[model samples]
Target: MLTRLAISGYRSLRDVRIVLGPLNVVTGANGSGKSSLYRALKLLADIAQGRIIQSLAAEGGLQSTLWAGPESFSRAMKTGRQSVQGTVRKSPVSLKLGFGGTDYGYAIDLGLPLPDSTSKFSSDPAIKSENLWTGEMMGRSNVFATRSGPGVRIRDDSGAWRLAYEHLSTFDSMMTHCSDPHDAVELLRLREQMRDWRFYDHLRTDRDAPARKPQVGTYTPVLAGDGADFGAAVQTIREIGASDEMDEAVADAFPGARIEVTSQGGMFELEMTQHGLLRPLKASELSDGTLRYLLLVAALLSPRPPALMVLNEPETSLHPDLLAPLARLIAQAAKRSQIVVVSHAAALVSALDAEPDSRQIFLEKRLGETVVLDGVPPSWTWPTR
Candidate 1:
């Protein structure tokens, strides 16, 4: 489980770090950088898939996503006594994201490449440095794998640093290329853990949404990010003998309602039997709020849980009354997977905060930088290029 998350030089998250728990609820007003934090986590997951550079490019490259404020805010600037203005940059353009767990930690630094007349992708951000270390915090002695620009090195079993690659791609991550099971066991393990990290932002509930249509029946342990296989996932959960929990979740949220996934001719369709209704309502016939809540249920009750699961604005389209049940479902899921919920709903936030081992992080914009209002920032050290 991730115990600490650190982000710097990304949107409003200019040097932000926070300790995490099994169940973490992040709440803040609009523009408090909740979305930025979510995207940062997603970017970290993308690194393990060898798509970090592509993800950054989709967001208009690094220059557009980098922190726009000054390198640092002075006392007077923060107090509004002085106008906020840019200062001479003391370092190169860098955006870093990292997370530390009890057994391992990983960080990656991205920076703008030097001006090159021959390269049309000069505007793209390059992977500057990366580090995979042991324990809860990174230190010089604990680091096992290191990447500096085009060079990659890993500590052998004899504890000697061995050069792994002389010319690694600037846009590629060591997590993808250097995770050899024989030479870099830690790297391979950490890389796979990161690859299994799941993220669910928007689960469409529109008329044309994929969840509304029947899909081929398959054993789906994990729900699709878009909830296209909602029925298959629910059926898988039921087949795994977790039908009691699934039924309880549905009834808790919708009172007398119970969820069902019917398979006809190898096509599965989701249905919900509610009180006072002679016929069960199909996924396409359900209300927007109801279908969305069911999608969240299927996602949380996934048979194959991830190492980390992140939900962004899950309260969207959810009724106030359903927030408590959703919160309860999320709390239960946290038992199997570390969850980070980014939401603005008071009911959901309060319900999640009351869960055991739950931690609440309230963010606020201070001097145009996102700052945690809960407590002191976690100790984090970024890899230097």
Candidate 2:
């Protein structure tokens, strides 16, 4: 489980660290940087997949995503004795993200690319440095693998440092370029775990949503990000996963409700049977809230849970009454996987707060920076360039 998450020079998250628990609930008002935190986590996942540079570019390049505030604020400025203003350069401009768990930690630093008129991709940001270390906190002595610019070094079994890659591309991550099961066991394991982190944001439940259409049935242990295979996912849970729990979740949310998957010509369609209903309601016939709730059920009840599961604004269209049931479902899922829920629903937040082992992180903006208001911030160290 991740014990800490750190982000710097990213949007409003200019130097923010969060302590995580088995189940974490991130809640704040609008413009409080809740979404920024969620996007930062997605960016970290993109880094592990060797897509960080491209992801940054897609978000309008590094300059657009970097913090727009001054490098540092003096006490006078913070106390309103002096107005906030930018000063001369002190430290190099960089964006950093990192996370640490009980056994290992990883961090990456990204900065503006050196001017290169000769190359068409000169505008791309360069990965300045990266570190993979053992233990919960990163330090010079604990680092086993380090990446500086295009080069990477890893500690050999004999305790001597050896070059792993002399010309690794700045656009690629060491997690993908130099991860070897034997040569870099920590990197390989961390990379695999990072890849297994699942995120679900605003699953579509429109009239023509993919989940509304029947899809070919297969043994699906994980639901697709778009929830297009929700039927197969729920059916898989009923067959191989916790069928009783799934049934209970459905009935808890909708009294006298039962879900079934019907197959016709190898395509599976979801059907929900409810009390006083003449016939079962198909996925397409269900309301947006109902369909979305079922999709959440399928996701939370996944047979093969990921190392981390993040849900963004899960209570978007959900009714207030359903929030309690949704909270119960989320609590149940937390037993199997580390879950982070970013929501604005008060009822949901209150419900989740009642669970033991759950932590609530309330974010607020101060001096245009995202700050945690309710919990103690975790200690974090960024790899220097």
Candidate 3:
């Protein structure tokens, strides 16, 4: 689990450290920097996958994504162009993201390449530094792997820093390149753990969504990000993961309603048998709420759970009435893996808060930056180190 995250020079994050929990919910109003926080986490995940540069480009590059406001606000400051004070000294354009977790901690720093008219990609960002350390926090002594620009270094068993065999590209992550289980256990473990962090954001549940249609049956332990194989996933859960839990979840949500998957030949379809309805409602006939509920069920009850599961604005499209059921599913999922949900729905937040250790992080806009606060038990705090 990621215990702490520090982000600097990233949109609205400024210089911030977020201490996390097993089950964390980030909430705030629009423009409260909630979305920015999510994007920062996603960018960190991209680094482990060797896609940080692509991710940065997707967000319109580093220039627009950086904090738009001044480095610091002063009461004596003026808005006029000439009246405004210009920067005294040049500073490196850097964006850094780091996370501390139980087994390992990692951080990556990105900066713009030197200006050159020769190559079109000269404006692209480059990885300036990265570090992988032991324990749940990062410090100079705990460092296991360190990368400075194109050069890479790792710690040997004798507690000595050794240079890696080959150099890596500026846009590539050493974690994705030099990690080897036999040679670098810590680096390998960190890479694998980071690779297992799953993210489910705004699942396409529209009328055209694949989850809304029948799909071929397969033994799936993990649900796809898009929920395209929802039926197969739920059926696999019933067959291998946990059947009782699936029944209880449906019964808890819609009393006397049971969820089942039907397989004809090789095709699999979802069927929900409710008490009031004589016949089981097919996936096509179910309401948007019903389909969405099933999708959530498949997601949470996944037979194979990842190291971390993230949900962004899961309350979207669903009616308020389903928030309670949705919270139950989320809480149940947390038992197997850590979860972080960025939500603003009162019902969903309230329902999840009833869980034993669900942590709430209420974000508010302050000087165009996001601040996290908690008004409940199991209080949340920022990391001091």
lDDT tens per residue, model 3, 127-167: 88888887667666888888888888888998898888456
lDDT (tens digit, per residue) of candidate 2 on 1-385: 8989999999999989999989999999898998999999999889778888888889999999999999888899899999999988798889999988888888999987788888887767889999998888997688899999999999987879999999988788999989988889878998988999999999889999999999999999999989999999999999999999999999999999999999999999999999999999999999999999999999999999998999999999998889999999999999999999999999999999999899999999898878999666777767778
Candidate 3 TM-score to native: 0.92
How high is each candidate's TM-score?
0.98, 0.98, 0.92
- Residue 271's lDDT within candidate 3 is 90
Candidate 2: which pairs clash? none
lDDT score, candidate 1, position 186: 92
* Backbone clash numbers for all candidates listed: 0, 0, 0
For model 2, the superposed segments whose C-alpha errors exceed 4 Å read none
Clashing pairs in 3: none
Off by over 4 Å in 1: none
Please give the lDDT score at residue 58 for candidate 2.
90
